[model samples]
Target: MPNLKHLLLLSCLGLSPACIDVPPLEDPPKEDPADPDADFTFTATPAQEQVLPGGTLDCDVRLAWADTTGGAVTWSLVSPPAGIELQPFTLPKGETRATLSIRLGAGTEPGAYTLTLQGKSGTVTKQATVSVTVGKAGDLVVNWVVPTPGKAYTRGPLLLQFTVEGGAAEQVEILKDTTVLVKPTGSPYSFTWDTTSEAEGTYQLSIRATRGGAVFTSAPRTVIVDRTAPTVASFLPAKDAVTVGVRDSIQVTFSEPMNPLSVTEAAVGLKTGAGDAIAKSVALSADGQTLTVTPLSDLTAPSTVQVDLTAAAGALTDLAGNGVASAPAWSFSVPTWLPMGGAVSAVGGATSTESVVLKLDHDDRPILAWAESDGSSKNIYVSRWNGESWFMLGAPLSGFSAIGTNAATPTLAIDTAGEPVVAWGETTGNGDERTVFVRRWTGTTWESLPSPTPPSSLDTLFNPSLTITSDNTINLFTSLYDTAGYSIICYQHSNQAASWQQPWELHDDPYLFNPGAPVSTTSGGNIFVAATVFDDHTSKRNIAVYKGKEPYLGGTTLGNSSTTPSIGADSNGRPWVAWSEFDSAPQSDGQIFWARWEGSSWTAPVAVNTRATGNSTPSLALAKGGPHVLTWSGIIDSERSILVSQWSANSWQTMNAPLNALSAAGTPATAPSVALNSTAQPFVAWTEADASAASIYVVRINR
Candidate 1:
């Protein structure tokens, strides 16, 4: 035993007497602990898990992990307390990856279900969370190609396609108001329903499917069937129409395809004001849309006919088994004859000259150009019919008279290219000075070319008649006058070039009369111009035709002195000449006379106006296969008015007095020009020659 201090020292060492006696002790053996570093991972992201009732999850999920401790791992669900089954719940030893498969029972609620999984290697453990949601499944889906919503559905074949969802695909049916449109037992079901025999209306459609002993019906879908009757889309010789030709056939176009056999003689008929005309035959168009009726005799003028479309069901039924919307009786009046029209508006105030040019286009619309006084200068103006009234085109253009020059003789002609070429004569300075200015409508603005003649010249060129042929040959026929009087002149160029050939004289002899600037047209192989010559030695007037080249006169007609002679050629190249001649009946007063040029010679002159005390300046117009329109000015009933006459089938007919209803009824209407549109409607334009002022007037004789 030691003292107390010795005992305290021994206690501080905290060793037993036996330990102090032993030499250095060896280290104790190490003990293995639970593995806390073990981790759970996924080869791919844990899928948003789901399963059908009594079915396994549709996705395959792999749960992978690594553990340092040598032991097996386990996987289990912690939520949904019980009901859910996880397959291969344990990741046994040597298994780095384990597949998790789950099954849900019918009683499982369709909501989010959380599944907790755990894995352990020896004493190490890890957890993972998997959440899943459930939903009600779809069964049968019905889709329609025809009768789609918010569209104009017509009576026709209706197409439908069916998609079978996770339901009993053994039996499926699509119905419209209990009528089965499709009944099949397959996954891809398609059906076509012909509504040709169904009445037009709206209805509901649904799909029914049977799964074992249960049944499912889809939501309702809307369907519409339109079986409406056809209507008259348009009719030739339309309702309330006028100026219809004498040899027109009755044509009726329906709104839709019709039964070809339905358009028979008994189904449709035509009746004149007097009695019914038998139909020779009824023909349907290739499309089964248009019905044409052949009459026993040709339809002529001065007759009114009514078209009767049958209302009987089978007579005019469409493919949809419906008759026309209504049995419309339409009436169109054939012109009492030719040369029939009403009043048209006046241009300017009234003062226009023989310079007024009228061109009848292929559409039968009339275009005009003239010189007028706007209180200051004589500016040129042009107007065209916009189907209703005359619409002025472009701004008033410059005329020679505007600058205090000599006379402004404006002339116009249109090319096949749709460009209007206008030319005029003006004296620029005080001395022997005059030039023929030419310009063209460049589709937008007028482009002026160099003067045809020197700015200063002794001779004056007037009555500039411009013509552009189909081949774009620009020809200018004018009257060059000096102290010796009128000479026929011509200037040539192309519409594509700015330069004109040297001015040449067609009839350079001053003694010959280039009647009305040799009115020329592009209707023949060579340009045709109607010219006149006065034999001072014989004192007889002769109407002559000039060709484009050296041999000037093709033919000539011996007659009394003629003034302002006009010429026109029909589509057949038949030339017609009309002019105001010196009449001895009224002691040298003007008389309107016309003559036709046969291929061999001229026909004897036919007097158009004898009763009129004075008549002059005949404007001639001929249609391709239509009528001959002749317009002029004369005194009718002691009042100066514009007059018109038509020659057709070797017959001449007078028209209603154009100025018969004008406020200035007695106003002298001169320089009458005529043009015919595609409808064979006549458009007449003239100058109101009042003592105080002159203005332009227009009228459209529509059909």
Candidate 2:
């Protein structure tokens, strides 16, 4: 035998016997009484009849339960109506009372419902009935499309037709210009709007149908009438071409003398670039040469404007005896400009994280320069390498704060004389914000041109695009926003004065918004504008390419059904696009992709960087005589660095240069911007992490 402690420890370890024993307890059961009487009962209140397309019925039911035989009782629903749902019930425990609520869906048909209540001491039931009526009324269907968007009536005829089903109706009328044009057909049931002779805006057709001594009126449908010639009804005050903020009136003279009869409160109007109409207190000169349009509120200077003349609405006639057919749509803009630069020393700025620039001036100096900036700043500073020394032009512009921050996409083009014309977007006001501005190096000092120049209602006025035709006619394109659904691109031309030609709207679609800066080139007699369009429906970026001098081009999408990242063209007029490939998994890295337009169709996209990991935001550049270079900042070895690759011999070459060497954890090297200089050398600009702050950096690489 072991010691007591050791023996106890061994027992605890279950060596032989480690069990303990105790006694169990028992409880008593009570006797059962006579079967519990059926005491649970429920009843529903009658619901009022409801017509179709009316409010929901507020229905309720009373429920009660009792222990008639002193036995526990429960309540339950046994019957319910189709399409009806009952809400929670408040039932008591012993002498329980409860309320039940029900909701009927809209599609419920006319019918009676039987509701039942079940009591379970065992099984007993009680039931009641309720009735609801769902009646029917006919419907009117509407369908319409503008053959020509925004133009309203330009060619052919304006036709509108409506159909209604139910009982015979009367009094069908189609209204345009506030006067009824189309009346009910002989059937008195349908209507058609034919604008063979009327002018256009918005026309409404209203009808009333009657059946069984009751009348139902169909909702009004709108038809646009276009019969008038487009006119320049008004020019904004600064059309005096004066600096903004000068107290001035809008100058609006008609294309022809107005009908003193048609220029009423409804016919003549003034509106902002934003589409908000000037208030009713508009003051007009009796001679009608100028109209002083004051806003209902204090106005902001440098705003775009449109002056409309009701004279086109069958009220005025042109000098040629033609009735003014279409309401004139004239657009005017506030001039804004960037005011710095000198003697074309250097040019280029990173347009964004995905763009780069290398600008070479026409000046004889052997200076190599580049420009690039991140979002939120307006300065396009230039750096020059004159073989032995490097010189920087102006300091980067802050957007326009007392410290100016946001910089526009600055594009540089040198006139034949080596004078540099800088086109870009800049902050015009602290609150209203952003304008497309231009500046020229006028032999002595950099001068600002008239600004707030809007290309289209849909344009953002940044990311300017410029193309100098063989004739030196500079064609510029930018993006604008409209109150209506789509964004637009505006076009302007200039050859002599720094002033741009009257701007024209190019692309305006309810489906396209924030189109990328335009890229253009003239081939033969056709002008081509290729831009990135953010499709509202697909929520993806599409490349919309249009041809001709028309403001907008018919757009075509390119690549593997993915949004594009950047686009460019070479001297041969071949357009190039770079974008990210579609990734099957979210959060997966996107691969760099490229596509080319071969004069007929867009080539299928080829993977430029085939990393399962990821690379993105690619920018492309091409020198007339060599391979195309595509550069971007991407992640490698879990680090973010600037990468460049070239397309040569029908294939992509591996990228080797790394612009940033900092730890990749918190630092971001993004928005790779690129440009090509006079010698065909490519210069790239970008914003990089500088230990504690952010700074703009550049690198030049030969192709």
Candidate 3:
């Protein structure tokens, strides 16, 4: 028997001694010493457990003997719950421990259950009980599928996946924030998220899993959906720029940030006019929006450069894995300007010359026409360059049978078959009556056009200007003096017509005199004539432009005190005029001025000559688009020299030096004529006079 203090200590130690019954202190039935009482106690550790419906609980059952000999113990479960399984095992001899395993089926119900365990050794038996509270399975778990976590998707199909654990799920849904994206079916719990229709932005993604009565949600994951294709916002040296610097770098700006790793040298290119690739290095800006291409060496002058950006699959890409929608391409030109070359004598002899006309053939060869004489009657001559020297085209054009007969004011044009056609004013008898005549070189001799009898209304005709249209129609413009007044007339001659068309009066104003009526044909076969007309109101000879025939569309007055106006038409049928005009006051000499017809009206006149004096006979020619090349005669350093200038980049740029010699001791160059070839290279011709003799000289650039 234990004292009250001992009982209290035993209870505090978790051992209750009150459960054990103590017999009175008396004599007991004695047994054989060899057959001592055999007894064992069955117990379980952790007698109470909390679990879910589809969970298992494991416990250990042990048997101990009071006698010295020990035997194996057989274990069994008593009154277990339905659908509950227990693993049965026998404890081996001399072993004091054994393991017990309990498993519940997935379809098991929730309830409070008591499981009994029994162990037997020979004829001795022991029993223990374990209390378990079975409830529903824990909440379902969801996880990411394809794009693990913290990943962005482009504007295309995106696959999402989630795995459910702990229990079978009846329904699963993928959500973006609070909005339901899709309700998926089938196994593996996956959905293909098509993000092509969504806008570019950031979104929170999560999964909702539901069973019979329980619902679970996964933590939100940040996802970025970007579907925008990069674009080229701007380019450095704008497209079709004609005056790009040789050392300029090509630059491109993007609409968004780009991937640095995707920008490589293979993604950009620079090429020459001849389609040859140039060496270049590519670099991306720090912000990844600007890309620059620097050529390893200086670019070629007077050449065109092409810039290209690659649109290949992996060539260029944005940070969100999007590529450029289309490749960007453009071309710019470096101006081709060279210093003037030395002047070369084209035709020189002991002969004096009058007016001269210069024109370039399709191959850039110079063709010249002039009226020359050897102290006698003047004769018309036509010559062309053979790349080395000049050669006469045919015999003398003026076949006069009487003395003192002369040919003057020669104008030249090239026909469709590249043959020289000349028109001149010829004195018919004893240099008294003058008439206009035309001749074409037929590779053998000069073939004269049918001469029409002069109408009785005109007295004399001079200043013949000629233009050949695309259809081989010969258009002639001449200044005439009649009994009424001095007038300008035009005549048309075609291969199909038996004779020249009747001359029509363009301007019949008596105040107009010395009308330098030059004719030019536009690409649309429309004729344009520029002349100097006297304005009675201002009492000045102002330059005027006339278009078409009879009821002329345009006869607008241009510069003041202007003369020797030359007209040319560009590809767009717009007219450009150049002439010589004297300064308003203080300055006494004439200067070269030019203007263009801008569809609605004429632009203000712009002076081209920078020299101080002697600017006359301005000739204008246009290139493919609208660039103007003007040449005129101006005196520099007290000597007459041929000056040249060009309209470029919205302003006129004069050449550094004169085209011919300006030495005071040398011949004076005058009456300059300028023409451009197919490539826009200029060729200039002028007559230099020395003593009583004059010679024709031509000059051009090396390129």
TM-scores across all candidates? Answer: 0.53, 0.43, 0.50
Please identify model 2 stretches exceeding 4 Å from their true place. 1-356, 363-380, 394-405, 430-432, 455-460, 507-514, 517-528, 535-539, 548-555, 560-565, 581-588, 661-667, 677-680
Number of the top-ranking candidate, with TM-score as the measure: 1
lDDT of 2 by residue, 1-703 (tens): 1123223333333221101111111112232356545455555543232223222433445545433433444444555556555553434334333434445556655444444544455565555555444445343221111111111222223334343333344444544445656565653122223345554455555444445555544334444444444354645653334233323455555553332323445656767778887764444454433444554554444466666665445554332123555655455544221101222222234233323344455653322222334444435654454553556544542334444455546656555566555666666655544676666566555666556455444434656765555565666766565534334454555556556777765546666666665665554445677666776767777666666444333244654435435656677676677766555566356677777777777677677744424566667766677667777767766767667777777877854545563444766676566655556555565556535444445555422
Residue 352 accuracy (lDDT) in model 2: 32
What is candidate 1's lDDT per residue for 1-703, written digit by digit as tens? Answer: 1123223333334221111111111122222235434554543223223344554442233544433324466655555445567654665554555446577776665656666666545555566666565434442323322222222233566555444445446577888787887685654455556666777786677777776656656545565565667787887877888657666777888887666645667777688867666455677776667877777776755678877775433468564446786766788887633332333323345444446777754455567777665454666666666565666667766634345544477777776666677877665665655667877777677777656762235677666777667787778887676756566677888856668887776744444553445677767456777777775544676666666654444334445777677877777777778878875666337888787767777788878844676787888878765677888888877777777777766866776554432456556777777776664556677766555666556665533
**Candidates 2 and 3: which is better by TM-score?**
3
lDDT of 3 by residue, 523-557 (tens): 56778887777766468888877775633324457
Q: List the residue pairs that clash in candidate 3.
A: none
Where model 3 places Cα greater than 4 Å from the true spot, the runs are 1-349, 507-521, 550-555, 583-588, 661-666
Q: Is candidate 1 or candidate 3 better by TM-score?
A: 1
lDDT of each: 0.62, 0.50, 0.71
Model 2 residue-pair collision total? 62
TM-score of 1: 0.53
Judging by lDDT against the true structure, name the best candidate.
3
